[model samples]
Target: MPVAGALTPIDWVTRFDELSARRDRLGAVELDELGLAAWFLGRAAESERAWDDAHRAYLAASDPDAAIRCAFWLGYTLGERGEAVRARAWMSRLFELCGSEPDARAGAIAMLCRSVGAFATGRLDDAAEFAERAVALARASGDTDTEVLATMNRGRALVFGGRSEEGFAYMDRVMLAISSGTVSDRVAGPAYCAVVASCLDRWDVERARVWTRDLSAWCDAQRGLEPFRGECSVHRATVLRLGGEWGEAETTLVDVCSRERRPETLENALYWLGDLHRLAGRTADAEAAYRRAAELGREVQPGLALLRRDAGRLGAARTGVARALGATPLTGVRADLLAAQVELEVDHGDLGVARRAADELRALADTIDTVYLAAQADRAAALVAIATDAPEQALTLLRRSWGAWRRLDAPYEAAITRMHLGRACRTLGDEEAAQLEFDAARTVLTTLGAIPDLARLERLAAGPDRTPAAGGLTRREVEVLRLIASGRSNRDIAHELFLSEHTVARHVSNILAKLALPNRASATAFAFEHGLTQPA
Candidate 1:
């Protein structure tokens, strides 16, 4: 529930409505920043003269796109105010200027300029096409800024297209690039951070922390970056949760959620709260947070995949994660990448599916200059390789991902991929290599205090080399060793005695050490000979 202090929805709507309708005509050609902002927000207090003033200044600016962008925004303001025909005429003028332009990114800019018109009236497909064309043009020109814009636009289309993976990848590239120090686009770093922060739902917290660290530092250094401060705070909270700093994480999220005005912001914060709770093993609290996020996400991105995922766990419906969605298409790298995700090579039921996905993503290297997206492409390809049981291919992709993640200082992702790499190697019978990778990953997980994961790694590493010590076992250890001899899984032991799996594992280790048993076989023989299952 929103605090009583929060502004009512009706009040905001009423204020904005009044602002949009109260335009005066004086100095309508030379609008300043304030004037343009009011016009953009449809505020009633703005005068037509503000738009005029802004238009004049835009014309006076050195950049050609500046004048054209002003023309479109002014036209949009007019259109929103019921001057559709006049707005269309202005848009036509902007399009004309987009052609034969001298700027290196003029083609991309032109494409995007055209897409905005399509997007204005909810012609999402048309907007996607234009944006896609813009991305292609931008990439062709080798302009990283244009590429970033194209990727963001493309990501929007991909999301609308029911290709969440593709949309996520494109946006990830833009965000990763920005956070990793390659923010070459019209969208400012802090602004895009909001978008990135909004995407944390259901993502692995450790993996997310890698990007959040850099993002947090950048947000601190930048001023006038308040638009996304709420989100940044939420991200920090998530990292703290992943690091096992539970109290701080919980406090931060609760505060952020309370203070946030937008449904989107609050919803995102709530979603992360759910994640934090779940990671801490608080099933009930996790469920509540997930329910809230699902309810809120339904309003914006209808049938959100992440919601569907949570709904599944919380006994909610399978409504959101549809196999097929009636989505509008996207243009450029966004579309290409999204298409690639929905068409995961796994569905093809062959090794070629993974290869195709990889190929599709690889084709985008020239389209966007964000290393983050490139890493995703590699990781996606690696996943495909794993599905196809191709260890070599998986290794190659993992290696690429590692390199990119290192440059981005994304240790969590690196650690995750390294774990996968170890698995791939283990499957290929390279235990020595597997053990080393597992050990490295274990160290990182331990620093982050992921006890369960650390224990699992320890177990995996202990699989090949150890034997029980030669000695008599203590009574408690003897009982645990007897269970181990019976071929019981950790789950079975935990259930039988109501002890935690971690505790059971510890007992088993103690037993092995006490009896000097070299292996499970010796422990089993010793237990059978002594009738170790009998009560003392």
Candidate 2:
């Protein structure tokens, strides 16, 4: 095990110099506290794999200070690399180890690192708690760097949870700290640009363009930040994706996925790849990537459930969603926010219960003003709009939802929001506007090869004014097929979609023809297989 205790001044300085040397190779066995700390902090400046290894070694060394250093960097590395499980584990460990007393330097840094990791992995509640802890510790010690980092993490988590204005304040503070020369984050942790891009993407194109320009300059200014090169690409890809550069976005994802370093980063690339594919009408490929990303995100329920839902594997998504919602280690606004996501899926599938769930989410949001949850609640409300047949209402909700999601630099969710907005346009009888929106969405999703979403959009591009995801099936056909697949009689089918038995028979015939099934039995089987119907 690595040792974290203090060392003689000369030996420590020499060891630290060796660890910090750009080209020197130091043996892990010879690592001391200062050496390990130097390596943990500077190794990432050397290489990706080396960075994580150093961080882990530092964490396991058992010196409170060394362990604390390791905890911080390791958490960020794990989260950045997409190892949410390991990241969460380290974060939890840090939380337990820190206890109530504030150790200022080590404690503040460790808590900030943990919170940042949590935020990255979709654990906003935990992120908020850790951020607050870090902030308190930083304030107690007057550690400006830790304070800024913690504030940034809190802002990010809040943005994801839907407390945008508050989150923006944090971002503003981060900027202020930067101006105050107190905004140093180890290993380029301060390089996240997606948030700024998303926040300004909708308001003024010139402003966003200029911000991105400055981002390029800032990235270049930080010469030793090469370890975050892939992350930088991810941020740029997000900006391009939001700016409507679909081809560029696809290219960027391909580049990110091809880098072949860090599991978390790979998972992120795959998630976006899957999303882009879905929007682009490439269902088959999208399904494949989504499956892998979901597996990677298995430690966190939200990521797993969203991927499953995108793939239309509802049973699996539902189970994950239910487990996530039912599992109670969560508190404050994050719980309400996550619950809203599950409820939205439930509401989307079960039209009868959508409104109640939306109402529940709204009421919950009223209790806490967090960034991540508020946006989640808005998404749920949009689902309700679709369920209630108010496309305009859904569009309005999507517009708001898009604003929140964009602020967090979460492109995957942003794509979905855009698609929903297009659906609203279709419902409002503006086929041209809908087509543009769908095309924009398709461009993003095509890169990911999202299957079901692609299939729905393809159906829309070729059909009349209808929600792309609802496919080309008319309302009546959707209803009749639902019942027929449920083993309902012709009479039952007619009653369900609201038509005469003769009309229902005609719908059945058309469905069989449309699906190119040879017989009613085949058509019925198809309906069940395609989720157009439920078992009786």
- Please give the TM-score that candidate 2 achieves against the real structure: 0.50
Candidate 1: TM-score?
Answer: 0.45
Clashes of each: 29, 30
User: Considering summed lDDT, which 10 consecutive residues are worst modelled in model 2?
Assistant: 1-10
lDDT of 1 by residue, 1-536 (tens): 11111211223234334444653433323244445434323342353455555566666665565566566555645664567787778777777767765454666766776666666656777777887888788788775565676677666565545455666677777766565445421243433653454344323233356657655665554333333556778778866754556668789898877777656568868877775555444557766877787688522122233332333332222222122222432222242333334223343334464466466556554344355556767777777665544667789878988788666565655666677678667545466798789878877776665444455567656653233431334334555666777888777977776667876676666566656777778877887777665554
Write model 2 residue lDDT over 1-536, tens digit each, in one string.
21111111123235445555743454333333333334333453333344445555655665565555556655655665567787678777676667677478778887787686677669998998899899989898887667777877787787668675677677766654553444443422343354453344222233334445545555544433334445556656656665556678889789878864656566767776765665565667666777777687623455445556656677786666556656553443234335535454543465544565567666655654544446667877886675444666688888888888777565656666777777666545466787788887778666655556666667656664323433455564567677777788998766665556765666677667656779878867777666667532
- Tell me the spans in candidate 1 whose CA falls farther than 4 Å from its real position: 1-115, 119-256, 272-286, 298-370, 380-389, 450-536
